[model samples]
Target: MQAFSEILDQWKTQQPEDNRDDYYKIFTAVKDFDKHIARRYDGLRNSWFLGTVTALLAEKIITTSDLEDFSEEAKSKIARALKFREQYEL
Candidate 1:
């Protein structure tokens, strides 16, 4: 499995935005998500990895249709994250 940071770096390279403001939004969201996970789970974390996914979706950076093409492992991770979010209302 790729670390969340590695995945972000890969996306940054692949997407190549000339303007960085949107990318900063993603970075901030992920950072906030990590902090929340640390506080709520006492460092027993899972959903932090989904921060970028959530942010991207919310910002319309990616679509639900795009998610349909994700690898099985990616899909599983997203499912787990969404489950966690729903359960905790976070």
Candidate 2:
């Protein structure tokens, strides 16, 4: 699996100049994601990942058309993280 920074770097290269700020938002979110995961806060990690993805979709940082450009491995990680979060849910 690619590290978050590598994924971000790849993604940043593909984004248009006007949408670069959105990449920063994703960068911050990933940092938060790492922190949560490191602390064993499964729920927060999932929530942050989902929320960040949602916000990205809503804000058009990532669109259906461009989804393929994103890393599939990253998406898989998010999916696995969500499953882990569900296991710990009450």
Candidate 3:
């Protein structure tokens, strides 16, 4: 939902009477958004889940509260991953 709003914000900037440069900016924004989606949604096998959720949290696309229902073991792992992100600025 947030990402859709982001896409809409990008879309709103390019008016009907906009110049070519403005359209190119919009194109770049959409391309960047696509990259974000692919990074988040691609290769979502169970093997890839921890890394994916860690990334989702790191990017603020999902919050820690969103993961509250998971098992404590999973929560521990995610906490460590979040720490690693903070340490390395990833």
Instruction: Highest lDDT: give the candidate number.
Output: 3
What is the TM-score of each predicted model, taking all chains together? 0.36, 0.27, 0.72
Each prediction's Cα lDDT score?
Answer: 0.66, 0.61, 0.81
Q: What is the lDDT of residue 40 in candidate 2?
A: 48
Relative to the unseen true structure, what is the C-alpha lDDT of residue 3 in candidate 1, on a scale of 0 to 100?
49
Residue clash pairs of candidate 3: none
For candidate 1, list the clashing residue pairs, or say none: none
Which candidate comes out best when scored by TM-score?
3
Which window of ten consecutive residues has the lowest lDDT sum in model 2?
51-60
- lDDT-based ranking, best first? 3, 1, 2
Off by over 4 Å in 2: 1-17, 41-90
Residue lDDT tens for model 2, 1-90: 245667677667776667666667677778977885565444556547655664455545676455565578766664565455567751
Candidate 1: segments with Cα more than 4 A from true spot: 1-49, 55-63
Least accurate stretch of 10 residues (summed lDDT) in model 3?
A: 14-23
State residue 23's C-alpha deviation in candidate 1, in Å: 27
